[model samples]
Target: MSIKGLAAKIFAKRIRKRIDTWANNPIKTQQKVFKDLLHTARDTAFGKDHCFKDIKNHKDFVKQVPIRDYEQLRPYVDRVVDGEPDILWPGKPLYFAKTSGTTSGVKYIPLTKASMPTHIKAARNAILCYIAESGKTAFVDGKMIFLQGSPELIEKNGVHVGRLSGIVAHYVPKYLQKNRMPSFETNSIDDWEKKVDAIVEETVDEDMTIISGIPPWVQMYFEKLQHKTGKQIGKLFKNFELFIYGGVNFEPYRVTFEKLIGRKVAGIELYPASEGFFAFQDKQNEKGMLLQLDSGMFYEFVKADTFFDEHPKRLTISDVEVGVNYVMLISSNAGLWAYNIGDTVQFTNTDPYRVVVSGRIKHFISAFGEHVIGKEVEQALKEGAEATGAMIKEFTVAPQINPEASELPYHEWFIEFQEEPLHIENLALQIDNSLRKQNSYYDDLIVGHILRTLKITTVPANGFNEYMKSVGKLGGQNKLPRLSNDRKIADVLTAMTTT
Candidate 1:
């Protein structure tokens, strides 16, 4: 074997050894994380303000610090951005990751020098974990095409502001730079359509074995490749063997991706956002990603139902229960103190502590007594696709409740299909049946006639993409809401069928 191949095997084995060690005793590993975080930032202003030196245990630490969201912490971040030293963490942050999340138009999240390890190191380990679990590393010798946003950054108050993936791209290792495709010129283009075209032109003949990105963007890249070369992606890239995706659940798009690739390839899921890298698929047999305890970030969970209450119950790793939804909170090295990142997760495993992201805390369909989540919608769509032999490209669900009417509300599903099903009504029926089987509350509501059965709206092939593009949210980790609590987005989509 080649020297490089031998080194790759050695690296994978080492990462697997570490994974096994940490997974053996999760609670102890978590406690060590908390203690280390306390000592690391004890001299910072935030630590001094919260009395971190005197707060010895979890209970005291919780009592000393209050939970906050991005808006609540904005003033302090603004001060740090304007050349203030040691306002939150030690000195200033490395850069700010800019995003347009639900509650705000543009939010700037800090990335400290201490927190940089969480972004890059955890990302590296996620790939290594997949390799260790799947036992496939031949792809390492070939190129990887990461369908990401522009790496160019804009200076905001003397600090760089751009997408987190873009920032990471700018700092890629020198050796791997040779095997990464889409030259700096193509990657630096700001337009998504033009940039994708440039990427296809640049990597059409390269030895690509891995392609990683959010699914929708990667699907678009695949379509572009087919259009240019008049060949299936499998034919065009014979060495392709691995797929990495995240930012949204992959279950709904699983069949579409398989069909596009013309075969099944090993896939890995990541749980990452601008706040922190939370988890990644660690074992091939398990569905949930192992909760990362020894990472630089410390985690806490507040029951989602009581997240907004005056006295919400905050639970540590020891208290978190399986199957219960909890809003995630963290005190990371990124100067965040019990900050609520707005995501809600449900624990699926407790021994080693694994979790699956259920949905956003503010984004849910609880307008009626029945509370449906993202997992239910994605799973139902997968079942619907199977029953009807359709390929759903994109979808969003919203409640159609009319205040003027005396009747109950019903759900409206807007779907974009790659291959149109023979019976659209049957597809809708299958999806409704699948959702009822999964959610007891929803089933009870349907049985009681409180809410009518769901209604499907067949949209143009690229309808969802067009809507996202119209709103200027076409790419890079921005997902169209699958389930909205109200009819505002539903109404907009209904009107788009006419346009």
Candidate 2:
């Protein structure tokens, strides 16, 4: 057997035992994580400030360390950036990941020596668990292309700082390093268009067996390859068997992926962000991703509806219910104390907890008092795309609330398509129906005639791409916000596309 296949067999055995052990009693695993942190950093400033030394359980931990977002925790992070040791964790962090988000221009999230394992080990186990469940290890012996950013990092104070993907890419296994592409030189190209051209040139004829990246960027790479090779991706790399994606939900882009790959490949979903690698698709039969219970982080959830309340009730793993949208909070080894990451999620399965990312808490629209979230808009778009044989390249939704423009406020969806629908009106109907089914408030608004039916604006192809380029965010890691509560992004896009 090949070295990777042999390694996969051994790793799979370890992961299988862990899966059942952690699943059977998640509360025990969660409690263990909480206790471990309290024990290790009881002497640190944040530890003493939060009374970690006296905290006996999760309830006490919650009472002492109030929930906060990144902005609220900026003072503590500033200390870390200024070279303070034992601020959030014991000693200093190993690095900081520079994240570009919608609300914030830049967010520098710490990555401690302790928290680094949470990223690496979970990624390894995600693959090992897949191998255990599927028994498909042949691809392990072949090459896998992880499309990521440049590994070169900048020194900030005493710590290295760079994009999360770039930092992680530097740690590719030696065995896989032989096959990973494009080269560091190619990846370092700052311009997205130039970087993409380089990636296509490097991997067009390679024996690629697996590909991992954010879906939109990967789709761009595949299309470029097809155009250059004068053949489909399947023809260029017949051995390609796995499609690993995260950052953006894969549902809306599913049909586009099929067209690019030109064949079926196993899809593995991961919920990874600058803060932590939170979950992974554990079973092919399972509906949602399995949460990482013992990954050096304690998890909490505040119901999304009440997330903006004066005093929101935070629920631990033991209390979170299935089917409720929540804004997640984490107390991790990176020195963050009960920090809210802004993204929202819903528990699809409670036992052996599994979750689906609902949407960004700040990225929702309630212009007409019908709070429409990211997940609802994407689901509506997905259903619409599938029903009308439309393939979406990119999309965004914004609230149109101008009093002069109409009698009532409604949603305006700006979509760029890979394949245009036979009739866009049919696509609109499918989207409206899906939204009404998912959110009753939205349905009631339609019924009460408080808002008119939704309007779909189909932009010319590459319209969204040009906008991203103009903003210097045209790349794989960056994505267009699918929903916005305000018209900031929508107005800019509408103006650009109309011109």
Candidate 3:
């Protein structure tokens, strides 16, 4: 057998063994095992630190550890850059994963050598689960294409500066590496134009079997591919089998992708962040399954309903109820304890821990399944406004579903700009078109020219900044609220519209 095939077999066996253990264990036993793993991780990262020493005796070690967001961890990142061991963990961190944060700022999340295995194992389990679900042995032997960022590691003074994607690519098995497409390692953050060009050039003549990445980037790649090849992507790469995606929701972009590819590519959802690969889509054509890295981190779930109300109930993995939404809390080997990542998800099943992402607990508009979150809407606005040569000073989106039968509800875009409005209607159309192109659901909903129209209202040049200052949130860390669930913001937009 080929080395890749052999490796796959071994990986699959290990995954099956783990799954069997999870399936056979009693609930009490499973809980104990999970707790033990968390304890071990805690000891490994902060055993000697004064802050963690008392954790053993503390009633709420998880709670006392302090729930941290990306901004809270930036200082530790500075420490890593200085070549000092991270305060969060006992030893030196292995790499930093760079990702865009809520404020449109860059965040470098630390990952340690001890924590890396959890990511690798979880990713493998995700693949194995796909195999098991398909019930197919000897599936097509073809190269899998991971549409990842540039593989080049940032460096200082000739030493390797590891990024998460770089570390994964660096440590990947030699056999797999041999068959993989050449990564765009010439730059740190990919030069979008050049990277797209390279991807098109490389794959134009090759038989790409699997494709994976964020939906927007993937769509961009295929669009570029079509432009170069003079044929649709589905026709060029006939051998393609799997379409794995993560870092963003695929539902809005699904119809466009399927239509472009001309077939329903087996989709897998991956839950990976800078810190780690937390979970992935387990079964073929199924929603994501939270593969508990019992050997690496401790997991907790806060019931969604209780989160916003007074007195929230925190549930362990064993306590999770199927079909209920929960905000995930994780204590990982990288030394984050009881960290609330802000993403909310629901348990689809519990036997193997399958889940579907409901939405972000914070920073979102969910009047419908649009699932339009702050980051996404922000990007859409940026792209749309920039395309029209209009620089946006600030903007907010709120669902304005009219209560009256004769009235129509649409997204009221309260926009502030430095430039005079050239054409408000044209700008609004451009924003709507950008959103529709990016999100298929938005396209479908807008097709009949019914439900949720985009209404643009120009505000004073410094309106958003003024609003931010008013809220005591004016700074590098603060961002304009893109999506608001409450009607208060909508009321303000209405007031702005009238005035």
Candidate 4:
């Protein structure tokens, strides 16, 4: 092995041992993080307002700090943005992770010096863990591309502001800098389409081994490569071994990706957000990402079903059980206290605290009380595709309460197919059956004559991409919702079908 590969193997072993220490002592590690976060921020304005001085335990914390989303915490965040010191964390944050919000317009998430390094470390550890478990360090010498936002940052109130991915781009380790692809000039392009084209031109002939991004954008990159070279991605880049993705489930995209690549490759799922780098896939054979119990963040879980209740019970890692969906609340060194990050997760393994990002708390179809979630829909589509040999490019689900022919109301699924099934009706039926099995309420609705089985609305090739483009969210950390309660997206997709 080369010097780089040999070094990676040694480093990977150390990281694996460290991971084991924390993973085995989940509760103790979390308690330490919880104590450290409170103690560090005890003198901040928010700490004083919430009586952090008197808080001694999780019970005291629950009494002192109420759960707050970004909107609810904006009063404090606004002051921080206006250059207020000690408003949330100790002093001002080093940077603000700017992200788009549906109701709140723009959100500036604080990234303190203490918190920023955790993000970098967690991401680095994820790769090291992979190397240790897989025993594959040869890729360390090859070129890798991270499809992400521009690294350019705008300064505001003495704090740099940009997308989280862009901010992370600045922290690439010096050793790997030589192997990272896409020149800085190409990555800084404002337009995603143009940026992607530039990236293709820069790295198409390089020794690319690893690709990382959200699924949609990575799919776009793969498609661009195929269009340019007229070769399957696996053939075009024989060493493209590992796909690292976050922000969405990869199950529904599996068949399409396999078809596009012409072979199966290993993948690593990451559960990261503006709030924190929460979890990462550690083992090659494991089902879920290992939760970061010692990453300077304390976690609380509220049953997602009862999250909005007047007194939803908040449970820690010790109280969590497998297979139950929970809305994760976090108190981190970055100055967020009891903050609801809006994503729901389910523990797949509780012994070492591993979890899968199930769905967003808001991204579901509950128009008729059936309350279908993103996980169910993705799994259903996966099941249907497997049974009927269908390859889907993308899909979304929304309720259709009214029908043009005065038929019974049903859920409308807009699907973009890479390869159509022999019978579209069979695919729909299979998916509906799978969903019915997963959600009892949906089954009851269908049997009680209140609603019919789901109906498929086939979207043309590249239709979803066009929809995202129309909204100016075609790429770069943007993701299409897998489920919506309303017809906003469905209506636009319906119009495309007619035109």
Best by lDDT: 4
TM-score of each: 0.96, 0.97, 0.70, 0.99
Tens digits of lDDT, candidate 4, 118-155: 99999889899999988998888899999988899999
Q: Write the per-residue lDDT of candidate 1 for residues 1-499, one digit (tens) a residue.
A: 4565567668988987988898888888888889888887788777888898998999998899899899888888778778777877887888899888677668888988988777787777877887776667778888898888779898877778889889889877776788898898888887788888999988889888989999988999999899888888888889898788888888888888888888778777888888888988877678788777877778999998888799898899899999999999998888888999988999999987889999888888987867898888888989989998999888899887773368677888988888878999999899999999998999998999988888888888778877888889887767888889987777778898877
Q: Which window of ten consecutive residues has the lowest lDDT sum in model 4? A: 198-207
Evaluate all candidate structures by whole-model CA lDDT and list the values in order. Answer: 0.85, 0.86, 0.64, 0.93
Q: Is candidate 2 or candidate 4 better by TM-score?
A: 4
| Model 3, span 134-247: residue lDDT tens | 644343366666666556777642234554655676666565565466454532334555665776777788878777776655776787787777776778888777787776
> Which portions of model 3 miss their true places by more than 4 Å?
1-11, 23-59, 73-82, 135-140, 155-163, 184-189, 308-311, 366-499
Error of 3 at 68 (Å): 2.8
Best by TM-score: 4
Residue-wise C-alpha lDDT for candidate 2, range 203-230, written one tens digit per residue: 8778888889989888888989988988
Which residue pairs come into collision in candidate 1?
Answer: none
TM-score of 3: 0.70
Clash counts for all predictions = 0, 0, 0, 0
Best-to-worst order by lDDT is 4, 2, 1, 3
lDDT of 2: 0.86
